[model samples]
Target: MTRLRMGMIGGGPGAFIGPVHRFAAELDREIELVAGVFSSDPGRSKAAAGAYRIDPARAYGSLAEMFTTERARADGIDFVAVVTPNHNHLPSARAALQAGLPVICDKPLTATLDEAHALAAVVRESGLPFAVTHTYSGYPLVREARARVAAGAVGTVRKVVVEYPQGWLAGEASGKQAEWRVDPARSGLGGCIGDIGVHAFQLAEFITGLEVTELLADLGAVVPGRALDDDCTVLLRFANGARGVLLASQIEVGELNGLRIRLYGDRGGLLWRQEQPNTLTLHTLDGRTEIVHAGGPQLGPDALSRTRTPTGHPEGYLEAFANLYRDFAAVLRGEQAPLLPGIGTGLRGMAFIATAVEASRAKAGWVKLSV
Candidate 1:
C-alpha cells in the first residue's frame, strides 16, 4: 500500500496539539508528513518543517502557497490536517477542499456558526471526505459503549451526564493554548463550551445516537479578568425524549482532563471515563454491575477493530486518536472505513456552541438548536 502524503496547517513551535496530531497520524504508519505551513512566521514554519523532517522545498510560508505548490506536485499531499486555532479552521479547510484535498480537522468545526455553515456548504459542493476529530469517539471502549446502546443492551437511553473539567485555567492562563482559548477573537463566542464542552456534548450524542433538540446553558468566567467563560453547565433535551446534563469547566480546582460520561437507560446504565479509558462499567436494573475491559472477548467488531493492545496492556489517548487517522487513511485509499464524525458533526458542534452562548446570555433559558 502506498503511504498517503499528509500536510498540515498551523501547529508551530509552542503549539500543544500539533505534536499530538503528528504522533497519532504516524502511529499507524499509513500516512506521512510531507509538507506544512506551520506558522505565519516563515522562519518558524521552516523550523517546524525541519523538525518533522519535511523537505525544505515543500515547506511553504502560507496555506495558499502550500496548497498551490503541493497540488502541482506528482506526489502532492493526499490530505490536509487543519490543526490551527478555531478562527483559522474555516479558511484553511476551505482552501484545502477547493484544492481538491480531503480534510481531517480538530473539533468544534470553526470559530462560529456562520463559518461552519459556509464551510459545510463548500464541503457539500466539493464532495470530499471531511472528518472532525472528536477524539473520545475513537476509543475502543467508547465504541463498545455506543454499540451496546445501539444494540438495545441498555434499552432506550433516558438520561446522560457528561463532564470535562480541568484546573489549568482555575486561576489565570498564560500559555499559547490557554491564551487563544480565552480570547473571543480567536476562540469565538463560546469559550469553555467551545473548548472542552463540545467534547462532552459530542460524546453524549455520539454514544447514545441521540440529537440534542434543545439546551439551556449557564456559563461563567470563574477567574477574574478572563474575557470568556472558564466554566459552563448545560441542560440538554434529546430528540428521543431523553434529558441530559453537561458540565465543562477549566476552573475546577483539582481536575485534569477529567472527562466522564454516564448514560442511563430503562434497563441499565453505562459509564466511561477518559482518564480510565481502558474499562467501561455497566449497571443493570437488577443491581448487577459489570466491568468490560478493552481488548476483551465480549466487545463487538467495531470495538475490536479499534483495539490494538492485549486485554491488559492498555490503549490510551494517542492510540484512540490514531484510530481516526487509520480509518481516514483507509477511506482515502478507497477502502471501507468505520463510521467517523463528519461535516454534519462539525455543523452540529458549532450550532451547539452558538446556541449555548446565546442561551447563557439570555439568562440560561432553554434554546432550540438550529442545526
Candidate 2:
C-alpha cells in the first residue's frame, strides 16, 4: 500500500505537540508529512519546511493556499492534521473537510461547544474519516483494559476514579504552551478540564463503556487570579447508576503528567496508570490479583495488534500516539477500527466541558450531561 500523504497545520519552530504529531504519524511509515503550513509567518513556515526537509514549494503560507494547491496536485496530501491551538481547530478542520479531505485533529474539538458543532457538521457533510487524538486510548494496556471491561472480566462496573495532575502551571507561566492554555479565547473555559481533564473524562467512559449521565462540578483556578479553572473536581453519575470522581489539576506541586484510572466492578477492579503504561492490574473479589503486561499472550486481539514489540520493550506516549495514526491509516484504507475515537468523541468531550463549566459557574447541585 502507498503511504498516505499528510499536510499539517501548526507545529512551528517552538511548538511542542506539532513535532510530536509529526513523529507519531511518521513512526509507522504508513503516513508521511508531505506538506504543511507550519506557522502564521510565511518565512517561518518555509524555515520549518526546510528544517523538516520537505519540499519548499509545499510549505504554504496559509490554509487556503495549501488546500487549493495540494488539491490540484496529482499527489496531494491524503489528509490534514490539525495540531493547532483549540481556537484554530474548527477553522482548519472545517476548511479541510469542506475541501473533501479527511482530518485528524487535536483534542477538545474546538474552543467552544458551538464551534465543535459547526465543525462536526462539516465533517459529517464531507463524509470523510475524522479522528481526534485522544492519545491515551491508543495504548496497548488501555485497550486491554477496555476489552476486559467489555468481556465482563471484571464484571459490572460500579465506580470509577480518574485523575490527571501536572505541576507545570503551579506558578506564573508565560511559555508558548501555557499562554494559549491560560487564555479563555484560545483554550476555552474550564482550563484544567478542557486541557487534560477531558482526557480523564474520555478515558473513564472509553474503558467502562458507560456514558456520563449527570455531573456536579467544582472548578476554579487555584493560582491567585487566573481567569479559567486550573483545578477541577467533578462528581459523575454513569448511565448504569455507577458513581465516578474525576480530578484534574495543574497546580499540584510536584506531579507531572500523572493520569491514572481505577474502575471497580461487582466482581473485581481494574487499574492502569499513564506513568506505567506497560502493565495493567486486575484484582478479583476473592483477592486474587493479576498482572497483564503489554505484549503478553493474555492481552486481547486489539491490544496485541497495537503492541509493536516483545513483552519487555516498554512503549510510552509516542508509541501509543502512533497507534492512533496507524489505525487512522487503516481507516483511510477502508478498514474498520472500532477502537478509534472519532468526531463523536470530540462532540461528547465538548459537551462535557460546557456542562462542567456551566455547573461550576451556576453552583448547580446536579446537572444532566447533555451532548
Q: Please, what is the whole-model Cα lDDT of each candidate in the order they appear?
A: 0.92, 0.94
Largest TM-score belongs to which candidate?
Answer: 2
Top-scoring candidate (lDDT): 2
Clashes of each: 0, 0
| lDDT digits (tens) for residues 151-256 of candidate 2 | 9988999999999999999999789999889998988866999999999999999999999999999998888879999999999999999999999999999999
Error of 2 at 203 (Å): 0.2
- In the predicted model 1, the residue pairs found to clash are none
Q: Estimate each model's TM-score.
A: 0.98, 0.99
Q: What does candidate 2 score on TM?
A: 0.99
